[model samples]
Target: MLRAQDLMTENVIAVTKDTEVRELALILTENKISGVPVIDGTGKLIGVVTESDLIFQNKKVHIPTAVAILDAFFFLESPEKMEQEMKKMSGVTVGDIYAPEVISVQKDTPLDELATLMAEKNIHTLPVLDKEELVGVIGKSDIIRTIAEGR
Candidate 1:
């Protein structure tokens, strides 16, 4: 069975947290990619920045509903969710909007498992790691190609 190492793109295009959002947009446009991994100064994967995150900047924010009960205020919706949306809308750098809770996979992970994870999580890009080291990246396109190739 094909594994993440067999399908992942070794020459990954990654960015640092300090990378400007504008530059990231340009990279994605030019490379025709949906997302890129964010790394630290030591080249450790930190997060991921995606087209969806960039689009969030232009989306309308949904305010959390609240009600005043006596002297206390009760939020009908998650205020933290609203705050996160607001931050993403006003973000200027990859660090400001990148998803830190990364959904990554190991190099030896089976393609079937990878596909299931991507489908269930609605993820377009997944980073592959080898013993805590970034090895490659797998995108939705790669999976599609694999399917087309009947692999």
Candidate 2:
């Protein structure tokens, strides 16, 4: 019957939108954590940035297939997807590439619900919130640690 507050790691490491990608990478490497929460100037939780965002920079762009008929051209795939990929590929800062949708849990959230949300969404770092304020974070590693330690 554990709740998020039971095991969530306090003293969260967070970054602002303007933080450079290189600095963010260094932070993750030095801390040995996969990701961190992104906060705004007001310290409001705005998003979560992870290692995947960094990796996205190196992924090969899959150009959408297109065909031409009459006097117009048709794209077999979504051009918007390609545009998004290109943007991420050239991102210089956390603001350019961070996942803006904040998938967070409150301190009192049940552990089971938190686990389920993470599994379903494939989230690695989940920010723990108290109202609109950033408080702590939970990660997949935390869940694994809890299980392995038989807590």
Candidate 3:
């Protein structure tokens, strides 16, 4: 049976917690990855950062203006106007966006279970660990390729 070790990428590209968001963004773009595991000085997995998190980081909350009344004429209007909201979403750090609670799978975990976990959680990537130490990462593409290999 296929296991996490069989589908994981051993040479995983990880980043430190102190890594700047701009540089991390470049890393993600250059590697064409959806997310990366955040490690500390001792290489312990502490968090996970995804592209969705970065894209929506520090997004300004929109507020509705007022209630709208039906016009007697053919004119129309929408109630949830956002012209008054200020653009206060310029700066944010990875620490501000990263998910501190990470769910990792052990190397011995079965591939079928991994697939189920990924599908159920709607996650494309998961860290693989061996006794709390990051050994690799299993991405959706990796699982697909592994299945394609007739394993």
User: Which prediction has the highest TM-score against the true structure?
Assistant: 2
User: How many residue pairs clash (N, CA or C atoms closer than 3 angstroms) in each of the candidate models, in the order given?
Assistant: 0, 0, 0
C-alpha lDDT values of all predictions: 0.94, 0.93, 0.79
Tens-digit lDDT track of model 2 for 40-92: 99999999999999999999889899999998899999999999889889999
Better candidate by lDDT, 1 or 2: 1
lDDT of 1 by residue, 1-151 (tens): 9999999999999999899999999999999999999999998999989999999899977878899999999999988888888888999999999999999999999999999999999999899999789999999999999999998
RMSD of each: 1.3, 0.9, 6.8
Q: Per-residue lDDT for 61-96 in model 3, tens only? A: 655444446843332333323331221133345665
Worst 10 residues of 3 by lDDT: 79-88
Model 1 residue 40 lDDT? 98
For model 1 the local lDDT of residue 32 reads 93
Model 3, residue pairs in steric clash: none
lDDT of 1 at 147: 94
Off by over 4 Å in 2: none
Ranking by TM-score: 2, 1, 3
Q: In terms of TM-score, how similar is model 3 to the real structure?
A: 0.77
Evaluate model 2: give its TM-score.
0.96
Using lDDT, give the best candidate's number: 1
Once superposed on the true structure, which residue ranges of model 1 sit more than 4 Å away at CA?
Answer: none
